[model samples]
Target: MTGYALRKGLTFCRVDGRFVFLDLPRDRYFCLSPIADQAFLDVIAGESPAWVAAALRDGLLRETADDTRPVACIPPAPPRGSLHDNNQIVSRTSVLGALTRRAASRVWLRARPLKAVLDRVQERKSSRAGVELSVAQISRLAASYRRAGMLVSAHDQCLATSLAVAWQLASLGATPHLILGVKLHPFQAHCWVQLGDVVVNDQLDAVRLFTPILVV
Candidate 1:
């Protein structure tokens, strides 16, 4: 009997008694049936595929030849920008804008649905035509977010920071890319905002450490 293993980079969360799987590489999510969920759990516990096959009569736990290879989901590279620029001038208006965006982002991250937030981000990105913000402008926006304490005090960490940054950028008629990445071995997950290849909310060196699972 061939051996089987749970696919790598597959993270799951339980919602309403059902297991919702997040296929990180593909950026797809789906709920598993009770039987399939059980099989998956068993495989994750290091049980042999033959043992799992006994319970899953439909052969849902069949072994695959390429079990160790990592999945890739790279998107077309966007235009790159400089990592460093002159500090943005902090004005009363910029401060007020950051505060408003931070408050809104906090509420949206908590009260709104994940799909809804993603949809809105996509809509904003698509709606903006040829209006791209320069590196200095993005830097200034990020600085405003920092001054408003949006980046440091967010309870949701990277998610909140990314959302706040994206929101602020969108309001300024600049589209920013939201990226989700995962690191193996230690199993770390991070989200950040970017404009083209330029890291917006976080340092580029830090983001380069993880493999991007989703870019939007």
Candidate 2:
């Protein structure tokens, strides 16, 4: 009765009622058939590898005599910035700037190739001046985008929100890290922007549930 476990650097998410596996180290993704998905879930939940192998009459899971790798690590939080009051008034200039960048982000996502878009974002991060925004300022910028209908009905909300926030931060001369993360079990993927480890555009608790697969 050999025990089985998910491989290191591997995560899965259920998208549109199907299980999708991500091998992070290999940068590959695989969609699992329903039977395989159930087998995987059973194995990871402490079923014997040999039992699953016999049941399927095949090698379904990797046998692990000893598994040592940590499945996830939470990044250290960044130094705290000044907290902003929810009622703080946002300046017109900041609101307009965020809206403009959000529009540009939507257009770039639609028109450009993904690699090209990522490269352009990387360039912005590298060339950004050292200016930093307060938590209040960042919150205000995100609010402005939401209020302006920039993110309304976005097909990929995480991608759209991350891009919009990244652009808004860059416009303010701050370099932001765009992050992509995955969580197994219930299986989900999420994206967000951060300054250091401080999540700029999403709830810290929410982002903490995911294991970061990419930080751009």
The candidate that achieves the highest lDDT relative to the unseen native structure = 1
lDDT of 2 by residue, 1-216 (tens): 554545555555544445565565555556666776666555656554335665345432455556422222233454243211234466667667656766677788788765567667878877885887777677776666555444344335677668878866876789887877766666667877878756665666677677665556
Cα RMSD, each candidate: 8.6, 7.3
User: Estimated TM-score per prediction?
Assistant: 0.61, 0.56
Model 2 TM:
0.56
Q: Kindly list the per-residue Cα lDDT of model 1 for residues 1-216, writing each as its tens digit.
A: 344533554545443444455564455655566776665555655555444655345433345564332223454254254333336677768867777776777688678766677778878877763577776777787777666664346444677668778766776788777877656455566788877767776766677665565666
RMSD of 1: 8.6
Q: Residue 41 error for model 1, in Å?
A: 20
The list of candidate 1 runs beyond 4 A from truth reads: 1-71, 75-86, 150-156
User: Model 2, poorest ten-residue lDDT window?
Assistant: 78-87
